[model samples]
Target chain A: MKNVRLNALLAMGLIIVMILSLAAGKVWVSPAAWLGDDLSALIIMELRLPRTVLGAAIGAALGMAGATMQGYLRNPLADPGVFGVSASAALGAVTSLYFGYAVTAWLLPAFALAGAGIGMGLLALLAGRSGSLILFTLAGVILSSLAGSLTSLMISLAPTPFATTEIVTWLMGALTDRSWDDVQLAVPIIAAGMVFLFATGRSLDALTLGEDAARSMGVNISRLQWFAVLGVGLTVGASVAAAGIIGFVGLIVPHLVRPFAGHQPSAVLLPSALAGALLVVGADSIVRILPSVSELRLGIAMSLLGAPFFMALLFKMHRELS
Target chain B: MLLSFENLSLTLRGRKILDTISGQFQPGRVTVILGANGAGKSSLLSCLSGLREPKSGSVTLDDRALLSLNGKKRGRMIGLLPQRPDIHWNVDVRTIVGLGRLPHSGRWGMSAADHDAVARAMEATDCADLAERKAMRLSGGEQGRVLLARVLAGEPQWLLADEPLASLDPAHQFDVLERLKNYAAAGKGVIVVLHDLTQAARFADDIMVMKEGAILAAGPRNEVMTADIMAQAYGVEVQIGTSDTGEPLVVPVRRL
Candidate 1:
């Protein structure tokens, strides 16, 4: 019953933020204007609609993906962005650009998806072999560094300066000026990933106990791991391909909503997804209203907001350990 | 129907854990497994619970290979509690116990029968009062009982617990053993891994002794708890006596 209440509140929050997103920009379009055929309606329909929709979609995907990955691996630090899955995906999309495949719409997202799959597969292999959190984090750091360097190398080797600028801007991550075409490209794939991730909720709940007891309880741990990887790869890859690299939303949303969800992985999923949508949509609105010469990238804003929270969590953990 | 192992052997990495062990466990009896450290007693329990596969031979239940059944199907019949119990989240005790019903839960969630089972198990284990409490805040003995309640909530036909008495107080241990014995008397199988031979002798209907990854002896309590077998299994000198209740009592005198 509490979960239902929380879900209802989060849904309300998402709707309110989306409305604020539609009205916050330089063109102040009211909800009344959106109901009629006018300039305000056209701007809302063409511009803010896709941006708000993608923000919620991407946020929900990342949030669900984060909860799934953390629960499946039994590691709190296993978000797609933190574990280099996003960086690897960026590398893949940039590689497509380097090869002049930007003209084709599907190839970049496909390559990004493939890159995420490979990265996650390798992480699963490593994590399965060892239960050491340090080792797992080190492996992610190495993978992220390698992918980041490769992406920089591609930018340096691009044929033209304008191409370099475009790659650089895309790498920074934003949802500005996106149209229905971008939304159409990402929504279905993200939705599918969300389905896959949410389906593993029960298995994750069983995993709250160690592997041995979970196995005794009839959870197929190996299959659950594979499903988590496949789901995270698809969702995070598509989101990155569409809006570059939106970091911290995945990392922060689960932490914020875990308490209200009763800390059960199965219960944590839906609330985290809703909270994620709310966070992104709210952040996008804040960026629009701020007095700035240029639009603030959504990904950068999240990191700026989340890094301090991450630091506080680390310190709290340290104090608990000591 | 019987739970029996046939020449079961298991090797971990390189070293052998359980070496060609064979045994039969019947319902309506509490079977206690006793062994010194590293005697593969836990490994045998793992095999019986279907968590670990034997490199050779088979474990069968009702003439069907236990491992051949899907995890949920097998879990509906057998529940195993490991030596260490851990709850990763700060969930409520009721929610933790509710996890035991996962194998039986349908798509929508737990049924009325499942909820009744959970409540009954918690009541049986004296954990119903702690239902709303955060599971992680429980003490060691409280945690053990909660975990036992979780396993009991499954209502499996066979209950296998490893070192369940380790962190529990003496009263809780006896209470738990009495519950297991009563469950067995009501026509279920209860297999427990115990280090206390005296308690095993007092509570178990049957006893299985292991040493060096093999069973030294296994039979009815009277037949298996002889001085010679105890000495051989533990490399110790023991004095045996009869309690006022007519149960056997074993005391370790010295290391051999």
Candidate 2:
């Protein structure tokens, strides 16, 4: 399929999913009720609209970040979380929850963003000037392990069971009861990060020829590295701040869209973004409509699906290698 | 125009890779660098292509410092086909070849002229029939041709290739050497590093022999392709003779 047509299809799919997200909850609100000044209209406007918008923004951010990472690293297994930004951001949010500072709503996200910034700074310090892929990947692994251990430590040391519950629940990731405040805080940041990721498309295309050839082709390796770090940090950090650690969207979306994009790194970016938004909003809607006591957490839902998909991907790669 | 370097030296990890090498490469000629392993042949090509900066010397293109030129301008002037070039994705051959136009492309994407260049490059390399095939799925020889077409698409004033025929069959090796020779014939500077002495002697307009990070011999091929130079540079007893077509051949007889 033509990239333009594929993009259009993805955009159309996203619009449908967004509408479903705005309407699918415990109490179903028809599209007609979304207009008038009544309880249904209030429900749609006050609650579901913000949640849907936030879901789309977070998904787009993660999707674009994933595509950028995979292209920059030239590894299909790479994702935004591989950079440790998401885990560090989660640690920051957990820290706020552990200290009971999350009651302010803004403090948690602020801490998460701060955590992401520190992770990015550390990454730049470790891998920035060298522009070596192995070094950058190893630094990310170390950062991820460190951040994960710290989060676990915070969980074990929670003062009360209730605090532990809150931290654990938030860490599972969801867009439940998210308001316009969350949307306002995260959307602009994710948009800004997307701009950075978008700028890397051409450079990523150059990188498919390997680092030496890329440099020969006028790609400034250090500059491209900085852009990848900044872009992934902001987008993944903001998504974690707003929606917790949503995994697999970045990893899976690019792969899903690559064939349609002619397998070009630059061509894969936009379609991945759109498909990511579609997947998240669609998944969130399914979780909302499930007949469970409480709505399933989106992060856990993604993991349940993503882990199996990951295994399948590994198997496929094994076959190809053999 | 001349692509020349002066007193170029490079040291990596406390080991000297290039030791104050100086040479001038003329346009419209195929200059082949021959050496043993670790003889700085590849490193010299890296310096000449602006892929590596020499420690304390200069590379100049037409009297302007090569390193001082911006990456895009330098890329437009010189294209390097590295040894073991990898196509990391499953992209088609046309797209792979089109990447050579990156340094000349504008923000909006490939121009009409850029497409023409890509087409011409594919035609020249005889890979137009493989344009729609996935690059990674092609045979080694086909992939090499596609990569060469990629460099040609850039239409740079200088082309430097390091062991471009490494993994190809003998037939494909001749094919690549002929392409390089034709490219130089069309008035672009061509520099290649080759381990095969006979191939170098057959294809090179000028020959440079390097040993232990220094040039052992360099001049017109007829002046430099000698048994004494081969023994000095490669530490091998060699027989230099002419083929039926009157092309020179260097056959290694024994270890020194």
Candidate 3:
């Protein structure tokens, strides 16, 4: 019941924001922009439509990735941002770009996808081998910090300051000046990851009771872990490559949406996707509309709101532990 | 067709958790594994539940080898409730209970039969009243019962629980044990690893006393609960008395 209501609200909100995102941007194309009319087609089809779709797809992917990892590990704090998958993917994209490997738009995200695979591989080899989530979280902290420092060091050693600054902005995150090609690259990867993660919703639900019980219920623990890692890696990694490591979309969207979804991990999955799409769209729209903040990226908007949220979660966890 | 452990042995971190031991679990009878702390009771349960593979033995359910079966298939036949289950997310009680219905459901959603199973299991565990409550907000006993509902709803042929009553109050403890007792009476094989000798003696059709990674005694409760075997297993003297309900009640001398 709660799920039905929330899905309806989300569907409505998404439709409104999507319309606003396309219609209210700097181009200010008329309502006819949605149709394939030439002038409006150049603005809407050639630009805003693709951007809006990309934003929603990446948002849904990141949201589902975050939801899957948290659900599987049984920890709310296990987002790609906090655990470092985003930074790792960024490092991969930036390094590939630094090496002139991203001459094509597809190459950067493709390389970023590979980087996410590496990140997840390392995580599974270290974290999944353990029988406990606490151990996994600790391992993630160490790996993420190491990845962050390595990224910083690479940026410092970079030869061209112009490209270095670009990389930094990308790492900090953005969804600005993205072309239709960027949308084309992100849509399929995110869509695939979303499908796989959603397929395992029942498995994630069983896992919350812990591994032993989950296994007895016929959940292949190791295989399920691998699937979750794959889901998070592809979705989050693809998003990082496309949108430059947009922070908090994956973490906070699920936190807000899960309650209304009745806390069923499976129910949380798709709604999380919808909420994720909605958040990025809303954030991107804000970035486009705010007059003085034309330079503001979606990442900046989210960080402004998300940093306090990170602190709140930490404080809340501390209180709960106490 | 009974579940049996053949020459099961496990060594973890260079120490034997379960020394080479052999046992059989008869169908339609409850096997209660009773032992003191550090006596490897939990490890034994883990082996049977396929959470941990025995280093040098096999767990067989009928003609099928548990070690060979994947986690999903084995889980269908074996319902296990481990000690101290914790939730990372705040989910509804019914949602948690519905998890037991996973083995019966497909990827897209649960069927009507699955929902019916959830409702019936919740009703059986006395958690239907609290179905709308958040799982993390429930009392430890309530959470435990909810998990029991989750396990019970799975309807596995063999139910293995490690210290199911460890944190429950007396009334809840009775509630949980009686449910297990009823499950066994219905011709399901239920193995409860317990520390409370009195509960084991009263409810177990068959009891095995484990000590030092091996079985000290194994038989019907009357045959297995001799004072000497209890002393060896628990490292204390046990005095047996009859309850008002004519079940065995155990009193242990304090270890000073």
Candidate 4:
């Protein structure tokens, strides 16, 4: 019932903020002018609409992947980030940027998605023979940390002011000057992620008890694990590559929603997806409103709010663990 | 006969776990395997449930070889409760149990029929009340009952439980055992690996005693519980007695 109420409020709020975000830019256009044959219509349709849609879509994908990973791994502490997929994806996007391809509107999200897929695939392969979740987590730590430092080093070595700015923007995350191309690139990948994860709902639910129980219940454990790996890769990879690191959407949204979804991992998927969409779009809308720094990134804004939020979450987790 | 293990031999890490063991489990009878630790009791159950492959022999369902079957086919015939279950999600009690319906349901979701079966299983195990509670938060005994409900809901013709009563406190232990006996009496075959000889003798229609991966004795409780054989398998002198109602009981004493 709380999920229902929250869903209704967030949904209405999302629609309202989305419209305002489309119109309430640096030079505010009348709603009439945007609907007419002015530059405002072009800005709304070709610029803001795609950016918002991509943000919402990627947010849903990341959120769904987080919930799925949490469910499939059966650990609340686990998320797409735990598997190192996010870091690997970031490396992929940065690599694309380092090569100057990140400037090409078409090449950016594509390279990012590939990097995510490869990172996740490698991580899963490393953890494949491990019979324990701890081993998988260990592998994730190794892969992501190694990848993360390497990405940082590349940024440190970047040749010019342009390279530094590009790296920083990618890392901090922003939706400014986002064209329709990014939305196009992210939607397909996110859709594919949703399909893969949603298809494994039953098996993931069975996995809650344990692999032994899931196997006894006729769930193919190895196959289901692959599905989870792929889902996380596709979703988190695309989001990170497209938007850099948007912190807390995966961790916070799913934790908040799963109990209301009856604690079933499968049931939490789309709800997390919707909640993800709302969070990113809503946050992006707020980023638009700050009059002082018009170009202030959505990612930086979120981290400013979420870093403390994350610290609180860590504290809560510690207390619960004790 | 619903299930049979035919000349089964399994080796793990160069040690024989089940050694050419042959057994027939019939419907309406609770067949209990009684043994000391390292007696290959859990391994034997694992082989029967298709968790592990026997090195040389086959477990069958109604003369059909279970070894040749896929997981789905075996799942319909045998429901398993392993010792020390490993959880990967924090699902509710009912949802955990509802997983037992996997074999009978479709890929997308559970059908109404599956839900009904799950409900019935949860009801039988007295866990219906805890349906929405997170399984990990439950006590060890409650968790055991929930897992049992899961296996039961799968509607398997045979049940395999490994030390199913070990984690439970005394009261709930008897309650779970009674449910097992009832399942058997309702024409389902049950093979339980038991550490408690008293409970074994109390509820089992036939007791198979094992030591070091081989059967020490196999017969009705009265014949299997003789002082000499019990001492040989257990490495301790023990007294066997019957209640006023004529049920077998074991009382352990020190080695002579």
User: Largest DockQ belongs to which candidate?
Assistant: 1
Alpha-carbon deviation at A304 in model 1, angstroms: 0.6
Interface RMSD of each: 1.5, 2.1, 2.3, 2.9
Question: Which tens-of-lDDT digit does each residue in A1-322 have in candidate 4?
Answer: 1256656765776677667777776767667777666777888778878888888887788788878777776666566655677778888888888888876875766776777778777766776434466777887789889888989887998887799788977788777776777777778888888888887787777776667767776777778777877777788877886788786677777877765665777777778888888888888877777777557788787667756766787798789779
- Indicate whether candidate 1 or candidate 4 has the larger DockQ: 1
lDDT tens per residue, model 1, A148-222: 999999999998887798889999888888889889999999998888898899888888877877889898988
lDDT of 1 by residue, B135-207 (tens): 8889987898889888999988999999989977899889889888877888989999999988999998899
What digit string (tens of lDDT, one per residue) describes model 2 on residues A31-145? 9999999999999999999999999999999899889888887878777676687889999999999999999977987898788868876876886445566788898889999
lDDT by residue (A1-322, candidate 3, tens digit) is 2377788889889889898899877667767646876787778877788888888888888888888877777778777877778878888898877777778767888778877778876777787645466888887788788888888887898878877887788786777778888887888888888777887777788777777677778787777777877887789878989888787777898888865776667778878888989999988987887887456777878989888998898898899989
Give the runs in model 4 whose Cα sits over 4 Å from its true position: A1-13, A100-111, A122-137, A159-161, B7-16, B85-92, B132-137
When 2 and 4 are scored with TM-score, the better candidate is 2
Per-residue CA lDDT of candidate 2, range B1-256, in tens? 9998899899999999888889899899999999899999888988888888889799999899999999999999999999986899899999999999999998668989999999999999999999999988999999999999999999999999999989999999999999999999999999999989889989999999999999998999989999889889888999988889887778999999
TM-score of chain A for each candidate? 0.97, 0.93, 0.93, 0.88
DockQ of each: 0.67, 0.66, 0.67, 0.57
Docking class of 1: medium
Where is the poorest 10-residue window by lDDT in model 1 chain A?
A126-135
User: For model 2, what is the error of residue A259's alpha carbon versus the real structure, in angstroms, after optimal superposition?
Assistant: 2.2
Local error of candidate 1 at B116, Å? 0.7
Ranking by DockQ: 1, 3, 2, 4
